[model samples]
Target: MSLKSSITGNTKVLCVIGHPIAHSMSPIMHNAVIQDLKLDFVYVAFDILPEHLEKAVEGFKALGIKGINVTIPHKIAIMKLLDEIDPLAEKIGAINTIKNENNHLIGKNTDALGAKVALLNAGFDIMEKNVLIIGAGGAARAIAFSLSKECKKIVILNRTEQKAFSLARDLKKIATIPIEGKKLNEQHLKQYLFHSDLLINTTSVGMAPNTNTILIPKEWLSSHLFVFDVIYNPLETKLIKDAKEIGCKTLGGLDMLVNQGALAFEWWTGEKPNKILMKNKIIEFLNLKQC
Candidate 1:
């Protein structure tokens, strides 16, 4: 049966909201699992402007939208519009998932835990590990805050040195582990990545349409390091390919994306979605292999 033919007035609605949302794969993966499980839900996407967010929230409440997955510019701004915020989401200063119970929206951040789960599932443990993170954006902040509590130390690098320093300072207040931020340059990348146990790229350096650029050189990557790039579009980023060539275990963002979406799905519907189905849908949509 066609997706539209399956929907009725009683079907619950789940959606993702963001600016420039045409690139989002949430609907593709989410709707695939919903159809496979024969759930009474339909997932959709919206391109909501920043100025219309308040009205959009009101509309969602009136429409009784079951759940929301936030992305990009909306992640931080949507927190205040919600009825309640998870403590960890508040600490991370961002949220990517929201559950609405009778018009009461509760915000949560699943990106951090999702990344951690992805690594653990791949046989990597962050305990006592030294991590080097690239970029100081929302994704980096979420990952670093979660890793700081478990990892031995973390070094954040970004083009804007002060932004990295600012994020480091914020994390230091909440975590006892050593946290430092520096300019994203060849010298610092060489210095920190050498002894680091894990390398995480939270930047848009190797994103689609501009997938040729990489943050660090292949020589800088060691076999002891595990490289992770948080870009799921192209699946195999230049960094991931380089790391694999160096005999280092590498992870792309597809697993993290599926993991986070799964967490949100469970939070909204109390039922576990088929993660493999969700992942395969995205891979098929992107026409790429899961690295």
Candidate 2:
């Protein structure tokens, strides 16, 4: 049966909320799985302004929305608004998923789990590896917190140097790994990449409409590096293209996105959706080659 035809008064609601949410492929992958599994749930997206977040939560509670996937600006802000937070998400200071049970909201961060799974699935080992991360936003925080557990060293570079330093300091409190934050520049990019085994871009630098932009110079990349950019829109960012051209192993954000969404899916419905179906639905919708 079609998704619309399958929906009944009892069908549960699942959705993702964020500002500028039009770019999200969450609904595509999620709904595809919902339909594929014949589950009594419908997935959707909401373009929620930050100012209306509280009201949005109230509405979700009133309407008994079963699950919510938080994104972008809402990830950090929605924490205090929730009734309870998972411990790891609290440590990361961000949440990308929320479950509502009997009017109480519980928040969780699956981004870190998503990234770690994505890397390991791609055969990139993080054990004792030197890692270079770009950006100091929520995504950066989640990825850094996860990588800190196993990686030997981490250097975070952000356009605003203070944010990078602040993230580094925050991470140091919970992790024993050598973590450094510095201003993002060609000099530092070159210096860090020299010894780095993994390079992850947590920023939206090469997202759609600005696909040509690249932070690190092509010359800075080496064959020994494994580049992972968390932007999956274009499927391949300029940074990924450059790294690939230079003979470096690379992984795009599609897998990370799917893995995280899958984690949220299972947490919400107690059903493990076919991750391959979720991923391929997105790849087909984006009309792009598989990354």
| C-alpha RMSD of candidate 2 | 1.9
TM, every model: 0.96, 0.97
| Stretches of candidate 1 exceeding 4 Å from the true structure | 288-291
Name the candidate that leads on TM-score.
2
- Considering every candidate listed, which one attains the maximal lDDT? 2
lDDT of 1 by residue, 104-156 (tens): 99999999888988888988899999999999998998899878888999999
User: Residue 138 in model 2: shift from native, Å?
Assistant: 1.0
> Model 2: runs farther than 4 Å from truth?
288-291
Please list all clashing residue pairs in model 2, or write none if there are none: none
Native-vs-model 1 lDDT?
0.91
